[model samples]
Target: MAKYLLLKHYRGAPAAVNDVPMDRWTPEELAAHVRYMNDFAARLEETGELVEHQALRPEGTFVRGDGEGRPPVTDGPFAETKDLIAGWTVIDVDSYERALELAGELSAAPGAGGEPINEWLEVRPFLTCLPTVIE
Candidate 1:
């Protein structure tokens, strides 16, 4: 099965949304959301399709090489970047269509009021090199 990456891109600015993002959500709503994701992941696991899944921290540093002796310079999380990725999930599927279907299901993750967040996800296939990618 080919692997795909389901990227989570946050649309709004973190600061502008509220002083606290998830904290702003009601306790019941948050629990429901968590349950939804848990159920979704469980379903995928039962299908033997989920290879691995994880969430990532938003903060990151970009390093640029200067010289052999000089240490690489670092940059921060750009506040102005429009499409800031919150996290990602990896799954193994048979084809691109199947990957898309999985991505669709993930996008339907529960939002407030038990409605689908309908979040945008970037679905990209993993590049395999075992069989000579160049050939």
Candidate 2:
């Protein structure tokens, strides 16, 4: 099975929906969302299809080439940058069609209302390979 990366992309500003915003959500609602995500993960695990899943921090450092001994470094939480990647999931699948199918299901991950977030996800094939030297 080939591996694929399902990446989350947000074109607009993200809704303030992090776990830290507990004060805004009722306890039951929060619990439900948590349950959904956990259940989804568990289901994948049971199927032996889940490779790995992770949510990434928005913060990231940018390095630019300076043609010197050291490259220039910049701060994170990049502002107004288009095509920002939110999170990713790596799964093993047989073919591109199967990968797409998995991606579609991943996009439907449970959110606050048991509804899809409608956010775009970028699915790219993983290149798992080792270097070879030919003489």
Candidate 3:
């Protein structure tokens, strides 16, 4: 099985059909969206395809080592100035097509008015370290 990453972007993506921000969504709609995401992950686990998933906080900083004896330099969260990644899921699937199918299902997650969001997801394959043997 190959591993693929499904990336959900908060910015730097095409506007979604249901483009209302999560903060603007009604409480009920937010709850339903959360439930749908959880259920999707659970279903993937049941199918033995889920490797891991995570949600990131909007606030983050960029840090760099200044020097061997100096403190690291820190920068602003800069969410407005940069494209923010909201979350991701790693899946081990039998084929690339399977990964695409799973990503499509995830992109169909419910949004406001209990309608499909039609969100865009970036799918990328992981490079394996295993050596290939040429016949």
TM-score for each prediction? 0.82, 0.69, 0.93
| Candidate number that wins on TM-score, 2 or 3 | 3
- Supply the global lDDT for candidate 1: 0.77
Q: What is the C-alpha lDDT profile of model 1 across 1-135, one tens digit per residue?
A: 899999876544233212235656788878988898889889889998887777777676778999999999988767756456777788998889999999988877766666677666789889886875696
Q: Each prediction's Cα lDDT score?
A: 0.77, 0.66, 0.92
Find the 10 residues in a row with the least total lDDT in model 1: 11-20
List ranges where model 1 is wrong by over 4 Å.
Answer: 11-21, 132-135
lDDT of 3 by residue, 77-132 (tens): 88577888999999999999999999999998988788889889999999998867
Model 3 is weakest, by summed lDDT over 10 consecutive residues, at: 16-25
What are the clashing pairs of model 3?
none
Residue 70 displacement in candidate 3 (angstroms): 0.6
Task: Give the best candidate by lDDT.
Answer: 3
* Candidate 1 Cα deviation (angstroms), residue 38: 1.6
Taking every candidate in turn, the Cα RMSD to the unseen true structure, in Å, is 4.1, 5.1, 1.3
Best-first order by TM-score:
3, 1, 2
